[model samples]
Target: MKRLILVVYLLITLGCDKKYLEAKPDRNLLVPVHLEDFQAILDNTADMNNSTYLNFVGADDYLTTNSGYQSASYLMQNAYLWKADIYQNSQTGDPVGDWSSCYKQVFNANVVLDGIDKLGGTADAKLAGVKGTALFFRAMAYFNLAQLFCKAYTTQGAANDAGIPIRLTADVNPRPARGTLTDTYRQIISDLESSLVIIAGNSNFKSRPSKLAVRALLARVYLAMGNYEQALFYAEAVLAESNSLLDYNTINATLARPFPAALPNGNAEVLFYSAMPSLAFLTSQQNSIHPEIYNAYSENDLRKQVFFIDRGNGIINFKGHYTGNVLLFAGLAIDEIYLTKSECLERLGRGAEAIACLNQLLIKRMKTGTYVAQVSTGSNLQLILTERRKELLYRNLRWMDLKRLNLEEATALVLTRTVNGVSYKLVPNSGLWVLPIPDNELIAGAVEQNIR
Candidate 1:
């Protein structure tokens, strides 16, 4: 009779009960997935794919790097280029796998969420907390797609421009059209806001979306939209919760040697962070910050010593510690929140506060007495941006920062190259700024390619 009941349910859903009964889910499948699994997946999102995101993140890293590779690598670097330029056949689909990956996360979260609603759980409050975290990851996954595949949250929207294909439900057939920027942001804000409520009451989210994490994400969204006031509001809230900094000063000694491949979370400074996807390409691409950037660091500046690996060849990749190991990213923390706050303050004419926030971060970066902020003569905006560059260099936020600050052109200015010793400008806001949608997906019937 139990088998009969299962057959009836499967038949109702798939019009085929035989397959379902034969598949036979194991006991692990029978149990409700909790915050653990959901958090585990969220803990692994990384910087520009390294290898994964690089396909979609575009070759800004390479094209823009003074010492990096040239057009051959840059041609297919990311999803930003016009399809005609590379694929030429319009078959490459940027939204395909991402659409699938994000939905996988969403599915995991939904199973957790619905299981709590139907099967019941160990604790009502705990279940609710798990639900909140799932919502945050789901939103984050979608937002990641939106920013890269969709147009900016601009005056004109999906009616005229492309937005990433939004996936609200779990169905796989008949993939949907790209959402408008407005609609995409609505989803992001909605998911985050709801998650905040659920996460606020529970304390078990050791590494998942804590109340602070939600706020940090919200601030990031606001910052992206150029909504400085709202950005400041949420950023300030997250900053208040952090008690530590990744202080650049002790980097060399803290972990010692080649570093641990990845920094652990809940550190004095790491509000929330994953070990992250290891960057083994260092052996090949030799990826690192430009030497000019390394030189810019003050002698007193500790971040350079801690975060950078200066090869003294006008190139300094991340130290052996980060890129060597680790296969994760995306947890949470106060670092980005502080940068968001600083930018918001500068935009709002709070120069002193902006500088103060930057100094707070910088001060912690250097020896207690070293590297003070001198009164700079340029726009406070530049100061905030420079701090952002120094602070978040290797974490996958730089390109977005360039976009948010409308500095893509400025970024482009510096991202030129001399292949065969022949100079070439990397084309600001180049079609290549976005990556080509991945090649494998175009064969699928449902996925839509980005404009290129």
Candidate 2:
């Protein structure tokens, strides 16, 4: 079934010029029809689990020298500078680009969902699991796309804000128009809430969606949306089931890849497994940690050694990825849940509880004996935010954090980059935070492009 799905995917996608919305599947080709076949479509991890890195490239966690900036592809160089236009009229067919990749995941999820409906019977555990998995994938893809392509969700302006096109079916002929930010997020939350009722508990294979994975994703989505109460609800739900954090002291920081391979990810911290698609600029040795971010970690913080490799002359390359390799892990993990929980607690005026919760994870991350429990004070919010930045670097959360935090005056940030003696800055709430739609999609004339 997997091979069959792959064949159909290749036949439809290879050398295709039509937008994802308009490209019709061949009627003559064998299509997935059975329950297992639909499951196979969801099981194709390469398509289902990999996501875009444009946000990562545009984020402030890393920096590169002028020569290194020149070495990057034109698209990435623009991203690094937070240019008004990053694509520069590039076509959409590139599978790793933000628009194409996320839409592809949405399409596949819709395929499985549409097929499941065609089965037309009372669903057994297997059938229900497949349905839940499809819903989770769709919601996850939508949440990720929203973070990059739409304005940050706020209670006030969401109704007026433009959002990515929301496609709910497998049919390709109908070009859906961009929906309201409220509608888009409502759909995401709806799908996740529905999946929560049907999916089983945590699966041994992290690649597959489980009950806890759904909760973890819900926690993350709510956090991004600034619904701190609901976010705390979901975060605590996940921690109730599984809240294991890897002790960095036990990991060998000297190895090229310190963590275990993600194929059989031994890292107990991971909840839902997904990775950012690889790009040359992100993996290049010339890329170094931003000084502000690098200096935040105290010398006794084991992450300083476990997460980075000093390449000499103060240039540091990140080696600590939960995916256990060069590919940045964008999936949910327990550590992130802790951060989310702590942040919510603090925002809700439970400062002492937030500090206690944060310390549970921080103790494991620091050297066993050198760790000091953080005290709850006026600085508790800033303290948790700092630790959040330090712990989740390169996991694809920083960009979203920047967007959400900037919604408030106190947490707003001004990001800057210097390339060839030229300085570029992206202010809080800049229109550039919302990326432009791919030119190919714009040329198709189905949806409106972002104003930036």
Candidate 3:
């Protein structure tokens, strides 16, 4: 089956009797909004798994095979950052699939949100928890789509800088306009806060929505808003709850094997991972492990084994520590939670605490005793950012991460390994960074058109 995307609208069907308002919830109009459904949607919608959307939006997995190889979608995306050659067929008309798919996930969340209202007194703490999670996830989905479908998050973006389509209601036909980036983020923050009320008071789905997901989402949102202290506050919430880290030894013992056939979800470092799709040979797809990633890994570095493979063909060899179908690793992991905390803390001038969090995670991954505080102090922020990257590389964190940092910094750092053998540079916050509005949506007037 395709990704778990169901857009249902539970519009009130008017009737003569009061019993009509109390009609049993229809699965067609509403899906199960418990923890199970929340996790299911999250697991299914991961960027790594199969999505005609969501692929090759610059997480640095785009490695070329031989000289003549072509990956159009990825190439066009990379053109805004890193290395991708602009060829004739490189453009994919409109980027409706990405816009549609992300919104589809949001639509699913909205269905749950609406169902919560209809469920009314039938709702328990578990339902409340699910509602919060759905809100957070919907906010997250909109946040990502907005960043991907619109221009950079600049003060200038406050205008109708052409952000992603805003789908607030579960109604599939909710014809909304392209909200401003600021407006979109405001809505995302609103959803997250509302979600926090539901997620925080519940204990049933402790490991699912729990309070951690809300805090994590809060941290992410605050970071996006440039509010470091608030971000730090929430990220610390997650770090306090779990000491989750990607233990290298555990990965070696459990997850390290061959490519997809090996350990599906590589180390304990994995914070949140979706189901591994049953697609054949994952690493060799359009966005494969860049040869630079393989080359950069030290022979002694344990992570090198899980991420790279030495195929003698000299083409591009890969190893996906997490291959096949996805399993939910997104919300409940210690790695990302800690990383989020570390970044937030560092940005908030809590250098020692940030470094401590960073070291805690690094020591676990590297199996080292500890890191020196003095040495890890001056560049604590950079260290935190880089660790987040190293930990979450190719895990679909790059696009937003780049957007968060200085655009020129991104242009300087992104190194495209190959593109028709002629290396190209990314344009940081260029218009190309945002996906072209999907072709179908543009031509048929299905969705608002984005500039090419």
Candidate 4:
């Protein structure tokens, strides 16, 4: 029956050639009439596990070997090089899998938000939690969309910069225009702040978001917008609630695989759960770790052992995913909070304080006794930034980090790639930073294409 239901879901989703966002409702499937029905829609991991295929491909964390390069699909190959059109052929269908999935989640959330008020009794009593969770999910979906479709939020031009459309209602509206970057961010923050007040303190299940999850996500949003104060405040607020770390020392690093393959619901550090598909080409040995990043880890660093699989071919593949599944985790975790706080402190010139936070996180990640506390004098800011890169690889934060970090003159970087002996570069603040909307959406007249 579960298999039958999934087949029906896929059939309904795939049968339409109409715009993904404006597709007519499936008359055969049950409408989410009850609160639990809406909750079940949220639980549909197929639609909700936000995939970061493009972000993962676009980031500079991994280098594709010639073999891997040739074997990859055209979409994957183009994405790796920051091409103007990732989907070169119109026959490839819409290249908006992540975009469509995100908004689908938004639609589900909106359904819950729209319908909950019409019901009564116990479901109404539980409305606060339901509403908060729906809001959080919608905010998360929009945030992800903004990062891909909009330019990095800069104070000077955000009011003019185009952002992804804001879909706040569940009505079958066919067309929605893009909002300004400022408007997009305002909606995201408004939803998060609203969620914080209503969401309960913590969830027994990591998959269900809570107050801490909302705070952590807000910190990430502020950090991207270069709002160091709010970022710091939220990071600290979450830490105050809970700052548990997964001690790498306790993990078995000697096995063929190190981290647990199935991160249980009660995993100590994960604040929220979401994952990207571990597509074979991305995680396979042919796509090796960037040499510089792999070499940066010290021999005693437990992450070096637990997070990678060294094939002895002088290249390593990542294995230290928080989700014990093959899927790469893009969820909120305490380690990210610590790093955000540290970056915020350093950016605010609280050098000593920043190093203290870094030191606290490192103690758990390093070998039991060999870990030495790091001090942030002048050189330590680089250390903290590097640690952030190393810790958050493949989590879909690197692209945003690149955008934000490149804004600072000191840390400005131009990403480069070499494939088949041909080198390509993506300069800092290039228009290429904003990805084009999928072609099908443009053809359908439902969305405008991003300017390249």
Candidate 5:
């Protein structure tokens, strides 16, 4: 069954238009027939679990030298500058870029769902798990895509704003039109809520989705949508089930990679394991941590040493990926949940509770004895946000944070980047925050291109 699916997948990969709007798998191709076959489709982590790296390139977490900027790929270069068109003159049918990659996951999930629907019977626990997994993956893909391709969701604008194509079935011939942002988020939340009722508990493997992962993802989605009460509810749900933070003091900060691999034996705080596709600029020595962010960590904070490598001559590179390797980890973890809970609490005016939640994770990240717990002063919100920026660095999250934070007056940012001798700035609420759809997708006539 696995071999059969692989053959069909390769054939689809080679022959179809990779754009989600126009992907056209051959009608004669074989489809998965059994339950295990569907499970195998979802378990293909390389296709199902990898996430977009463009957000990281565009984020403010890191900067590159002039030489390094020139050395980056054309995609990375334009993304860094926040250009109106990032894929200028790039070929239409490239199968390896972020658009196709995310849609591939969407296609795979739809395939599993179609197969599960055909295998109608009194579903056993295994079948139930498989169905829930499919729903979770589909929701996750849409959420990630929405963050990058759609405008930041606001109650007033979501009803009219354009969103990515919502593909709900395996049949790729149908080019679904770009729906409203409201419908897109509605589908994501509905799928997750359905999965929450179906999935039982945490899976043994972090790569697979479970009830806990569903809750955590829900928390993340609500946080992005600016629904603080719902975000707090879901975050507290995840914390109540499992809230373990890795002790940074125990890590060997001298090693090139401080964290262990996130499989077999990896970080305990991880709820789901997914990573960004590797890119040379992210791992290059020339790609140094932003000075302002790097200097924000206190001397006693173990993360200062545990997460970065001072390559001498004022070059500081990030080595503390939760993936335990070069690939940047972008999946759910307990630390993020704690931060979300704290932020939501602070927004709800529960300042003391928010400070406690922030301290709970901070203590684990600091040196065992040198740490001092933070109090609920007037600045607890800023303090929590500062820690969030530090702890969740390079997790493919900073871009989303920037988008959501910019909506508020106090937290809005005006980002500036100087390349060569020229300067580029991205103002808050600029349409540039919503990236343009690929030219191929526009040419396919399925969706309207974003105005930037």
Candidate 6:
């Protein structure tokens, strides 16, 4: 029997009421009957895993080469230039795969959670772990979708702003309208909180969800939500579990690819392992690191040597991805947790503790004994944020950071891109920050598109 591929939207009868949408997985053929079967669905990295290629292109991390720019797909080119219409038309199909892929994960996760209760002889340990994992995956998918599809979560207008559709069941009922931003976050946080208690035990595999990974993800989500205290709490909780940083001094940075790729554990710093598809790897031959970002790295910083490959002629490619593959690491790592904790601490007025955290991470990133502890002062928030940007470059984060930072009166960022002698600028709080929902989805689901 063929596998049942669950989907977010269902095609309804024409002229039928829009509220009564319905879709069903293949009922007789591929329903998961056992623990292992559900686990297999969760383990399908190709479908269940998330990718950040479109977000990476939209972000300000790397610039495409002239040939790379011309050779890219229509969606890639448009996203690279931040055009209002990335999908072109309904006939063009989905502009990016992340949207569908993430929702598929959520569907599969719901399937697993629903089926687990029906299975007989499922041990207590198996039940707890599997249920916790399903919840974690669902929360993660929702969080990723919210970041891309919805506007930034502002305390003021979040109750009114449209969020991605929230699906908690595997049933055929599919009248899934976009909920308010506040409702979306409430669901995400609720899932994470529930999963945190269930996955309290540790897992040996970084790819698997565990208590620590939940904490890391919560830290990331809260940070995005601009809740500094909660972000710091979760970040430090993850740090408390394991706060190891890779010592760049120990690695041979001159190798063709400096980082080890095939390690079973992936990069030691990674708290949870998730990555963008390898197809989007930014090679020096293809994409160049923005000059300003690259120049900000001091000579003493080992990341300049280990994390980047100098392609002579002013072109540089990022090499320091935790996955050690072209797949940009879109997962949680200790370095990010430390940075998050540091930033939250600084923002919350624990400046000295924040500097200490930065110093700890920088000591490992910099050349042996060349690191200097930075001061914990008001002016240094920008410095801290700059370091955060540098540390997490090409990890599919800058777009959301730009959104939250733009909300601040002090750090409102106006971004500009110059392509082929034409200049494109994105003003702070521009609606372009929220990308359009793919046309086919908007039509099929009877949903409204984001305002340009």
Q: What is the lDDT of every predicted structure here?
A: 0.55, 0.86, 0.54, 0.80, 0.86, 0.78
RMSD values, in order shown: 6.3, 2.1, 7.0, 2.8, 2.3, 3.6
Model 5, stretches more than 4 Å misplaced?
18-29
- Rank ordering of all candidates by lDDT, starting from the highest: 5, 2, 4, 6, 1, 3
* Model 1: per-residue Cα lDDT over 147-260, one tens digit each: 555545554443565555565543334446654567778778998998888775423323455787788789888887778899999988876666466655455543323333
Instruction: Determine the C-alpha RMSD for candidate 3 after optimal superposition of all C-alphas.
Output: 7.0
Candidate 4 lDDT over residue span 27-112, tens digit each: 44635555666566666666665655677788888887888889988878888899998777753565466767787778777767
lDDT of 3 by residue, 1-452 (tens): 12224322232221112334446655554455445554465444343222322334454554545422443444443442333232223234433445555666676677667667777722687667667767866877787677567666666545656666677766544456676777887788898888877764433322234455667667777766667788777877766665665456455433434323212333333333333233232334444555655565544455666544455565544443433223212233456678777777776667787777777766655434433333454557665776676666545555666766744462235434545556655545544455666454444334565554
Model 2, 368-394: lDDT tens digits are: 898889899855998999999999999
**Would you give me the overall lDDT of model 2?**
0.86
Q: For model 2, which pairs clash?
A: none
* Candidate 6 wrongly placed segments (more than 4 Å): 1-26, 91-95, 120-123, 280-284
Of 3 and 5, the candidate ranking higher by TM-score? 5
| TM-score quality measure for candidate 6 | 0.92
lDDT of 4: 0.80
Clashes of 4: 2
Instruction: Please state the error at residue 255 of candidate 2 in Å.
Output: 1.0
Q: Which of candidates 2 and 3 reaches a greater TM-score?
A: 2
Q: Across residues 359-447, which tens digit of lDDT does each residue of candidate 6 receive? A: 99888988887888787776568878999999999788888898899899898877777777788888888888888887767766757
**Candidate 6's C-alpha lDDT?**
0.78
lDDT by residue for model 5 over 217-259, one digit each (tens)? 9999999999999999999999998998888888999999999
